[model samples]
Structures are given as C-alpha cells and as structure tokens.
Target: MDRRTLLTLGLGGGVAVLALGAGVAVRQVMESRRAARVTGTKLGAPFRLTDHNGQPITEAAFQGRPSLLFFGFTHCPEICPTTVYDMETWLSEMDVAPEALGAYFVTIDPERDTSEFLKSYLEPQSHRILGITGEPEAVWDMAKSWRVYFQKRPLDGGDYTMDHYASIFVLNARGEVVDLIPYGTAADEAKAKIAAVL
Candidate 1:
C-alpha cells in the first residue's frame, strides 16, 4: 500500500476507537447523573401489594434487611432480565446472606403480569427473587412513592410493553433507600456499595 493510504487507514482506525471511547464515557456520565438524581432522596413507604403467589406482601416486609428493589414488567424483552441477572450476580459475588439481602422484582404492569405469570416468568431465577404485583392503583402508588419511572405502551396486537427505570434501589436494613445503583455498574463497585449495607 502507498504510504499516504496506509497513514490514512491508521488514522481512520484511531478515529473509530476514539469515537467508541467517547460514546462509552458519555454513557457513564449520563448514568452517573441519573443515579445522583435519585440518591439521598428518601424512598419507599408503607405500601400494600401482593407477591407472585397471590398472597399479600408489604413494603415493610423488606425491613430488617438491606434490599435491592427493581421495578420492571416481566414482558420486557431485554432490560428487565438483564438488570435482574446482573444484580443477582453482583449479590452472589458479594456473598450476601439471603437473610441479610432481600431482592425483589416489582412489576409495574399488573394487568398482564398476574401472580401466575410472574411466578412462571421468574421460575428460572430459582425463586431467589420475589415478584410483587397487585391492583394497578396499588402498584402505581408504590412506583410513585419510590420515584420509579414506568409507563405502558400499546403494541400492534392489542398488547403492550413497559418502560421503566433501569436502576436498582439500594435500601438499608431499616428499609430506607440509600442509593440508586445504575445498570452496568462495575461489579467491584457494586460489591463495595452492597457490602457497606451488609
């Protein structure tokens, strides 16, 4: 190859790398800012809901232990499962005792995500995570209290999908939300934050 052509190709490759790096940096910053917005804000309140088993469950049930709470519907194609798995893996790596750590999956779409649906949907999680759902008003009230953003968008075939906050609420043992852990957090960082609560 000619010297000029070789140099140009090298520069193009460098530009691509720089562009990718910049995109990553920007995303990290955005996620950090989003996390900051929700942190230091008192979250979670006394709210009544039901678990995937059709039994009553309350927010106070998470008290006496630090908990990781995520608000998403089971129908989510990617983000919901990915976030749950990531959080679960982080918890496992931290070696958090099941008693010391309460992990919950709260569904924002209660209409379609019935108790049976949630039970089957999370069966693969080995039942490690508890799924919460209830009447629309009850669920939405809990989401609003937690300041979680979620909305349902109708699909083509009379079905719908849920868009929700991708961050997990980190609650202290007293059940007070102490931090917002953003999606894709470095596992080491996640472990450190979770360990502090444990």
Candidate 2:
C-alpha cells in the first residue's frame, strides 16, 4: 500500500474508535439520569414500620423482592388511591412476573386505618398490595427514619384530615431504598423505573 493510503486508513480507524467510545459514554449517561429521576435517593436506609396485616413490618419484609412503597392513608381521596391504582395498572401491564416485585401501602393515619379496613380497601385493587398500619408513635418513628412528613389537620365538623408527603419509594431486592418516583409520575415512567430495579 502507498504511504498516503496507509496514513488515511489509520486516521479513519482512530476516528471510528473515538466515535464508538463517545456513543457508549452517551448511553451510560442517559441510563444514569433515568435511574436518578426514577429513584430520588440511595437504598438500604433502615426503616421500621407495621404491615397491613398488623405484623411487625420492617425493611426486612422488603428483602428478597423489589418493592414499590407509598406512604399515605386510605382516606386520601385523590393522590393516594390514584397512585396505587396507577401502580397496580402499570404492574399488570408489565411483562415481568408478579413474584419479582412487591407493592406496599403504608398508612399515615394509623388511628383510623385498622388492619381489617386496609385489607378491605386493597382487596379490590390487588392481592399483592400489602397494607401496613401501627400505633401512631410507631408510625411517626418510621416516618422520621425515612424522612417522611405527615400531620393531622382538624376540620370544622370535628373531623380531621391527614396531610402527608406523597412519593413512591422503590426498594431493591436487598431491601434498600434505591429510588423514588414523585407524585403525578406517569404510568409508563413508573413502570420503567420499577422494571429497571427488578
């Protein structure tokens, strides 16, 4: 081969290598961003709470399977039920098997949400959706451990409303908090997030 031809081939090969490297780097960055947006924080934070069955639920229950946990009460007319329904729908649509993922509804209004009530409420939604409720103090302690916030507001009719943060937590198989999906997250995005972790 001529010297000029050899030099041209060498330059072309180097350019191709660089382009491939750039493409790989771009793909990695995009995946990282998608994961971050889906799960807001790192997993493995020690969290203790009660399960809907009145059992002593802890982070350990979330172990062995990926979990999607939402902290809200059954009384939440808008955001709580809506988010649960969305998650159920998305999970049903997923190609993954149900055994690979778990869903939880942790109540902020423990005083009002008994185990029976929780079971009744979630029965129609999903058999896999576990409901958790405990003493007010225990619930508060768990909320504080997870950096969740909630408060009760008294109404004029002597009733009260429980105000709480609405964010879905995605925990990995190891029971670590891997990520968070903010309220109003689309079904597709939520499903994508859960699938990524699983």
Candidate 3:
C-alpha cells in the first residue's frame, strides 16, 4: 500500500480503539448511576402471605430489622440456588447470625411452592430463613410492588419454570430498599452494603 494509505489505516485503527474505550467507560458510569437510582428508590409494600410454617404474615412481620430478601422458586435449577448460596455465605461471615437479618426465601411460584413444599425446600436452611408463598394474586401483588420481575414459562411435558430477578434485595431496618446486592457480589461488597445500615 502507499505510505499515505498505510498511515491513514493506522490512525483509523487507533481511533476505533479509543472510541471503544470511551464506550466502555460510559457504560460503567451508567451502570453505577442505575444502581444508585434503584438504591434510593423506595421498594417493598404491604402483603399478607403464608409462610412455610403455614402461618399468615404481612409486611409488618419483616419490620424492625434489616432484611436480605431473595425471590426465586424452589424448582429453579441454577441461578436461584447459586444466589441463595452466595447470600447465605456472605451472611455466615457476618458477626450477626443470618437469621438476625430477617432473611427471607420468597417463592415466586406459588402454584408449585405450597407451604408444605416450601417447608421441605427450605429445610436445608435449618429454619434460619423464612419462606413466603401464598395465593398467586397476593404473591403477584408483593412482587409487583417491589418491581421484581417474575414470569412462568412452560416446558416440555407440561412442566414449567420461573424467570425472575435474582439479585439479593437489601432493606434497611425500616424496610426501605437501601441497596441491591447483585448475585455473586464479593463478600466484602455484600457485607459493606448490609453493614452500612445494620
């Protein structure tokens, strides 16, 4: 190629690299701002639901303590289990027992996650966490109020699965969402967010 043409090509490549870098930086900043927006936005609302124990409860039950809430179904194969494990691990390292934080394992699939099923599904949690499930309408009300995403999809042989937001929702002592702990966040990051209000 001619000398001028070669130089032009090199400069174009450099410009492309710089533009890509700028785009990445912009995305990072936007993501941070979005996280902060969700943090400051009020979330959670009143709902009377049945716990794994089959007792009726309302949002009032979770009042007066910081809560680490997760919405997933018992039948979830991967994301649900992984997120729960991460949150449990993060809280295990906390000086406070996980239960003290009012941990909740709310099932978004009420049709399948009956109170009896929820009891067995959470047995591994050793009663440290409460599982919430009730009528579909009540569950939808709770999920909708929090802006949590959840939808059921049918699979082969008439089976189905739940698609939901898997992040761990952090509520301050008064039940206002203060931050969202993304799934797989570093333990220190989760701890810092929880500790800030504890």
lDDT of 2 by residue, 59-117 (tens): 67777888888878887667777777888888888856668888888887889998889
Tens digit of lDDT per residue, candidate 1, span 129-157? Answer: 88999999989998877766666666678
Scanning candidate 1 in windows of ten residues, the lowest lDDT window is 9-18
Could you tell me the C-alpha RMSD of candidate 1 in Å? 10.1
Clash count in backbone of candidate 2: 9
TM-score of 3: 0.77
- Residues 1-198 of candidate 3: C-alpha lDDT, one tens digit per residue: 564442221321221111223223334544665676743335567889999999998998667888888888888776666666776676777766754688888888999999999898786854567889999999988977776766676777998776666667787777766676765578888899888768
TM-scores for all candidates: the values are: 0.76, 0.74, 0.77
Candidate 3 Cα RMSD after full superposition onto the native fold (Å):
11.6
